[model samples]
Target: MGLIDRFQALFRPKDRENEPATVAMPPPRPSSVLARFNVEQGRRATVEEARRMYDEDPRVRGIIQTLARDAVKNGFELVVEGPRAEEAQDVAQAMLERVDFWSRIDDWVRLTLRDGDSFLEVAANRQGDIVEISRKPTLEMYVRTDEFGRFVDPMRAYYWADRLASVSERPPDHAIYFAEWQIVQASWDRDEGSRYGQPLFASARKAYKRMTEGELDIAIRRKTRAGMKYVHSLEDASEADIEAYKQRNQAALNDPFAAVADFFSNKRTTIQAIQGDARLSEIEDVLHHIRTFWMASPVPMSLLGYGQDLNRDVLDEQEKQYRRTLEQVAQWVTGQFVRPLLIRQWLLRGIWPDGLTWSVEWASKEVSTVAVLAEVAKAVVALRATGIVSDETLLRMLSHVMPDFDVKAELARLREGRPDEIWRMAQLAGGQDGAA
Candidate 1:
């Protein structure tokens, strides 16, 4: 079959083909008006507001950037298994390259966590191959699903607001709808049974507000009250006298040059520096709020340079914890975004293997995964001498030792390279098994 034909077959299952992508949903406008109704939604902060924080606040920006950077810093590999596993791997890699997937991964990762949800639009060429994978604004796109959480018909996903050009042609919020398989979505910290993903920084809003305000308040206080605001008190002086004194020193109060001009005064005005005010030594409460803001997000305080007293042991512990976090984030990305695109490319190529199972593996950012997994591989390979574990099983087990190793293809190569040796080894393993 042709590429376009296969593409249609892959996404349009017989049962779901007749159904629309969406139905009976109201027009989705880009506004926070619905926020009042869904008070508990996204920790009471609208997705729009969260996006603003990402742009304006350094803390929010840092947290999201850190998540994206740390998540993909080590890179990942796709492991495929099936009769045509090698072909599938080759095709998937070529497709990813064509669309510049890795090159623009930062954008995808940011979109994944920017508004607590990510929406990706898959664009295909005339030959029905995916050529572009671009991000749609999470704030503008709306998803409609049935009671079972499955997509409705052509309206499964909609993008942009209802168009001003023609309401009839683009009725669903005037948004152009996408097919079930056309859009790839990834949500961060999503709430159960909710359509939209919970933004990772939703809970940090209040603390961020306090932290930012505290810093600003503290800054203003330091500049204004950090030093003495001299009080020139007049003892039994008339209003005219006080007015004359102010008129004379008004320039000195504002301008340093004018202060040098304060040569003479009628009375002995003892201008004592205002003592015991704006003591910055005791603003622990504001610091507490700053720490609280960092604590609210997934990015650890140490990751953002907050813990000054962190020792090597403490840092190692934090690194271990962070590695675990990255693993989870990688899994979510593989499942929601990466895997689906691979499958889509497979279908577009019309050579996708049936019953194909695959996983994306990552190199560790902290620990040396190869050395650690190599030891595990050694243990697994030892089982092969017993004749119970097959060579293929051993290769799969050792797959962690080398991220790009294709188990099935490597097994085939070994069989081709040394047929007699393979047979002899099998016989020897059988003898060992019998002796055992």
Candidate 2:
């Protein structure tokens, strides 16, 4: 042997018994509503169990096995079987017969997955289009995905069927009969006209009658997802509409919880379009664009629409003559009155002014806070003679100006120094001219 090989061999331990085998444990399940289904990690022995169940209960197991195969292929589990299977299927068929099977199925599927993590969880209803797989969830709340088979929508046919199976396992044939009753009732009342409808109806009627005579399948089509349709199946069915549907659905499925991100992204695209005024016809065009892109969204539509309406209202007000007068008044308040008030407040704080006022012609004069107060007092008295604002309105306006400046406290302090100033303000309000 080479020297290198010998060196490695010297360190090698003598062989003994092989290490004990360890069965790999399944991954930890997150504590979430999705865990309720108890989907087994890997294939496990479910197929075998299903097969054995099939052999033992051929009548029920037959359909269960077929559903199981579809489940495995579609990445879901079929939990319904026996009489329950017949009932849910009957109901499904009825729903399909009445509405656009595809559309109805999609709605039902969306409702189911609204609560759980289905592969089809991100699909949303956007405007009028069914966005199979959007970065954002659909308005209908269906999970969007790029691939049909990859993501499981809570409204998967397998899911609803599986739920039915579990109930059937517990309650016997009565559950199935009830499910049939529900389906038939909805189908009939809704004017469902499936070719198989009459046959299924007759079968349900016969079975229900037999139960009165004591031979009934007690199976229940337990609720899963929402609505009565299979939403995931629609996502899968979209595969035929065009290959892009499934692909898009799968992509959304890959990131099911990113509805906000998707919604914002769509919003961003719209905002960008309107940002450039050169591209749009006018401000109205931009506003309309926002309404279409932002307001039409499924979520917060009312909230967003309200804000947009308010903005539009303001714009509309600006166009009307009467409202325009109010608008100009507001502008004057902000620019002339409010701005000057703020500036005076700041200057008075620094200079410790007792009071201040200004000339309408913009000329300025001031000495101390007392002098300013005296000048404003005299001007107001003269103005009162001309009948501008009533004394009540002028007092109210003055009260607003020095709201926080404690007049009594300031007068007390001024009295300690210049008691004459206190008499001056008293004269302005009521003491001096008697016109007060």
Off by over 4 Å in 2: 1-278, 281-283, 288-375, 379-397, 411-419, 422-436
Cα deviation of 104 in candidate 2 (Å)? 53
* Candidate 1 per-residue C-alpha lDDT over 108-127 given as tens digits, one digit per residue, 9 for 90 to 100: 88766877777888888766
Number of backbone clashes in candidate 2:
50
| lDDT computed for candidate 2 | 0.29
Q: Pick the candidate with the highest lDDT.
A: 1
In angstroms, give how far residue 206 of model 1 lies from its true place: 2.1
Single out the weakest 10-residue window by summed lDDT for candidate 2.
180-189
